[model samples]
Target: MELFVFVCAAIMVLVGALGVVLRSNPVHAALSMILTLFGVAVLFVAREANFLAAVQVIVYAGAIVVLFLFVIMLLGVDRAEDLRTEPLGNVQRPLALVLGIGMFALLTTAVVRSRDSLRFKGDGVKTATLEDADGNIRQIARSIFGDYVVAFELTSVLLIVAVVGTVVLARRRKSERTAS
Candidate 1:
């Protein structure tokens, strides 16, 4: 049952990734990214990483995707306009297909090779217990506050900048429309 769920989640994640890459419209791509994040969260839950899964859903699928959608809506860019200026040409399609296939083959080979050499004593989920949870959480908190403090701070700053930028852009658009 778990294996089946994992397979389904993996398939969903792959399809979502492809959708994100292949969708011409930015909004559709952002929605696909949200789908991908949700699939990943499902996988995390299946693996018994409940806390991480919750965080993934809340932070990524909820906050980040909403932010992405807000930015896309605020930009007021038409999907038709973007499609007209697509970077890829018909001549490159075959080459791109071949390259993608080759990359997939390489990745499959790597996974097959890595799986053989891996050794496990017990089920990983069983080992990820509540007794260890407190220590792990403490370590993570310390690392986030210490080694990754600058990155954490920078992320907050970036988010603030994005919010301000979105407000300014929307206001400018509103003013322009009024003037027109």
Candidate 2:
């Protein structure tokens, strides 16, 4: 049963990933990304990471995807862009390809070197069980709220500041446009 669930979730993830890459429409791609996120959430559930699964669905699938769709709609990407246009000149593609190959080579070398050292060493860690499903979540909550509460609250304040800054900049641009 668990194997079946994992296989189904894996298939959803792969299909959604392909949709995200292959779809030409930004809205469709964002929807595909939601599918991918849901699949990942399902996988997290299978791994007994309920908190992570909820975060995956709520934060990524809900908030992030909606933001992406909003940006896509706001940008009005309905018009097809010319693929042949070299806005950055001919050097950009070659540079990107070379850099991509170099990064891939570096990652491959790192993986090969570290493959043997990547063994799981969870010695005294408590995992979720049927009797205590919230145990893992409680531990995570304690670590975050107890040990890192200040940092977490600081991050929220930073995000709020960023949102306010963006709104101010947007309003300034609109006023400038109207004045012009």
Highest lDDT among the candidates is held by which one? 2
Q: Which ten residues in a row have the lowest lDDT in candidate 1?
A: 120-129
The regions of model 2 sitting more than 4 angstroms off are: 1-22, 80-91, 119-125, 172-177
State how far residue 70 of model 1 sits from its true place (Å): 1.1
Which digits, one per residue and each the tens of the lDDT, describe model 2 over residues 69-143? Answer: 888888898444444663858898789879978998999999999999988875343578889878888888887
How much lDDT does candidate 1 score? Answer: 0.80
Q: What is the per-residue lDDT of model 1 for residues 1-180, given as tens digits with 9 covering 90 to 100?
A: 998988989988988999888887888888889878988999987866667788999999888889888878888852534554677688687798999999999999999989967775642233246567554455556778998999999999998998899797666666788999
Measured on C-alpha atoms, candidate 2 has an lDDT of 0.84
For model 1 the TM-score comes to 0.66
List candidate 1 segments past 4 Å from native.
Answer: 78-87, 120-180
